[model samples]
Target: MSVPAWLARGVFRVQEAAMRRPTFAMLAELERTQWLSRSEMLDYQTGHLNVLLQLALAHSPWHADRLQAAGLADAVRAGAVLPSDLPRLPTMDKRDARDNVERLVWRGVPGGVFPYTTGGSSGEPLIFYFGRARQAADAAGRLRARRWWGVNPGEREVYLWGAPVELNKTDRIKSLRDRLVNQLLLNAFEMSPVRMDDYLQAIRTWNPRAIYGYASSLALLAAHAEARGIRPRLDALRVVSSTGEPLFPHQRELIERVFGVPVSVEYGARDAGLMALQAPDGSLLQMSETHLVEVLDAAGNPAEEGEAVITSLVSAAQPFIRYRTGDVVRRSGRADPGGRGLAVLDAVVGRQTDFIVAADGRIMHALAVIYVLRAIPGVGQFKLIQHAVDRLEVQVVPDARWNDAAREAILHGLRARLGATLVVDLNLLDTIAPEASGKHRYVVSHVPLHGALAQAVA
Candidate 1:
């Protein structure tokens, strides 16, 4: 190996060991746990769940009240609370997390707490606190999942993602860090044809072991590449990891055909942390190491297809015990077809956000508009439908917090991100109905990206 390549890997190893905030310890542990018996894995998870429960009871007022109300507080304190007994706790929604951030946060966490907000893809934005251990778990879980496909840490890979605008500074530093890790990033927010061509060339030159990106963006890139006959001969690319949205069968086929690699679907929300990743055997296995996911029907019964309620085991800084994720998922009690000990999820039927074309010719993820509405407090539920490149229709169901200032805030927010030339129409509604499929999408764009995506972000 080249000296620098070896040096970077060595440095990362030292950092992993020395770093208390987020070490690679969990990644090492995952190697053996994946093959453990299902009962054994549950036992392991139950151990962590008990600790989290005790911590939440002592530190978090929100969880303490709920646990007490459920009459499980004393049991939890007496160390008799089992993981199976978790569902007894009442479920919390986005608003609960938002309104109770202070009460939920364990401000005295050792590594301190990291405050952040969701981009509002789930119809509302929430400010939550996550500690370093939670951060470490997410990173390590991903690394272990990558190893399932023979891709190791620091291997050459490409990230086609766009963080929220406020994370620009962090993104810049991350870009530099990515380079050190032999990773390249191609912005998904600005996917002009010219930029995509550059990305294709970069991917070919980089010869990455895998490609990771949004399902739709990758599919669109594949479509554009196929249309223009710009397929790069990537000999080392082993897999295409798709996240941020659902991977439709057709999109998967197109991506596989163009990239000549299997598409692995990763399902989770930022608020909940990394929940599950697709296994090599094609099973969507929940990260049983740090997450306890429950699938419940509308009436709150355990069903085949229903809302995904997640209890993040690592949510000690701010417990999300029995949190209603508002995502539709089907889970299998049957062992993972992959023969892994991780629990299997039949599917994560979550929000299908569209690609919005900005008036200035930028192609943005629906989360961009979701950011506008979610950031406004008075806006309860909203949908932004883009009918044309220059027009956006916003349907908002105002809440008690709604005021005249909120209306102006929405307009200003949209104008700032989408550009001034775009015409935005606001409509107040009592409720926003889901589609025939019974899926509620906060944002949908009818305008095609055929030529619109040809213009990269300026």
Candidate 2:
């Protein structure tokens, strides 16, 4: 259905305000209360599951049918269902969720639904619905993290992101509005060596209190500055937060060393909002009050630490129950130690789409290669591509700092991780190309579908 232009503009304005106002404050309070409450963690999980189930039955046809099919219509009558009952429900894949967007979307309510699109990093573009209330709650969670670095809304902020843009004549007005809002917009697609130099100068001149952007882009800037022996004074900035991709330990260390600020890391997906954030003590804490997180094993049962499955508690417009996030995270410890209840994300591996299978049925993630190759002294940029089940290719762009020892270290690391039986080939290249989304994938598998083999691959 076509929406009126004025209505669309009004929706955008409402969403922007909700993302930056009193709603965020309420969300922070709710998160604190939930963590401090004396209730058992299992009871909290069941309560949230029932809430989401009720919302699904009321609004989302996709979820309604799935629940009915599993004979769960009465199970959610009074929020008394057991945790063991959740496994009886069917699993929903990304394609299934995307195909039924209309059934999942609610319309004509002030804070009912918001349309969003994915970054298409996996070569799959999708549009989904999110409730404004949940979106506001998510905004609040982000603001709570920002508080760790002394950032406040309405203060001057700079955003460096990778969203698609139209550089038309209309950009003049948009630029003016951005400046009026005390915000600066930098495109991620235009990051070259020269462009990065200009960005550094802009930061030094504007001197915003906080800087937020993709971790990879910022790491590139730090590397360039280190190589050129140019250190710009950024004393005005209190914090630096990196999102949109996994922030490597080496990158975080380098950024902190160069900028002289604490580096905060966060994780999120476009379909949902912020999932987890690094606390002051360096633990990645899940937003338990606003969302429910599950770490499932290969058998689709709850694992002590495995793949992350999310069930958004506040999204009434489109319920995301037991939705696989394609991310691998391990549970930090037993749930609800003491009265403080929060799921701790111990570690995050690469995407489920980027796993490589070995002949012995072991699965290896892309970060394994990154952890090894990044330790090599002279490696500037690297990419690993898997052409078959047991064959892999490694491409590296070397800097002047690399020597024979660096190459040997990389080779040895690969052999150790993939086992000496697998074929490991290294190719020296001037540059490594990024994916279509302007992000790099550390691993790519081209093998056709095979059930058990696929499980082994992941």
TM-score per prediction, in order, is: 0.91, 0.69
lDDT of 1 by residue, 1-458 (tens): 21255655666667665666464777778777888898899888878888999999999988898888999988887878777797787788888998888889999987888877675554666778898888888888888889889888878888888766523655666656667767677877777667778888888888888899888888878877787877678898889999988888888888898889899989878899999999888889889988888788988888888998888999899988888888889878778876789888888877677888877667766766676687787887888889998889999888889999999999998988788877889999998888888877788888776642322100
- Using TM-score, give the best candidate's number: 1
Whole-model lDDT for model 1 versus the true structure?
0.81
Candidate 1 off by > 4 Å: 1-5, 11-20, 165-167, 170-175, 376-378, 398-409, 451-458
Model 1, clash count?
1
Per-residue lDDT of 160-261 in model 2, one digit per residue for the tens? 654434223346777655555555666544444567677787777767767777776666666666666777797668777887667777778878887888
lDDT (C-alpha) at residue 55 in model 2 = 68
Over 4 Å off, model 2: 1-22, 28-35, 38-48, 82-84, 108-112, 119-121, 165-173, 334-340, 352-458
Query: How far out, in Å, is residue 380 in model 1?
Result: 3.5
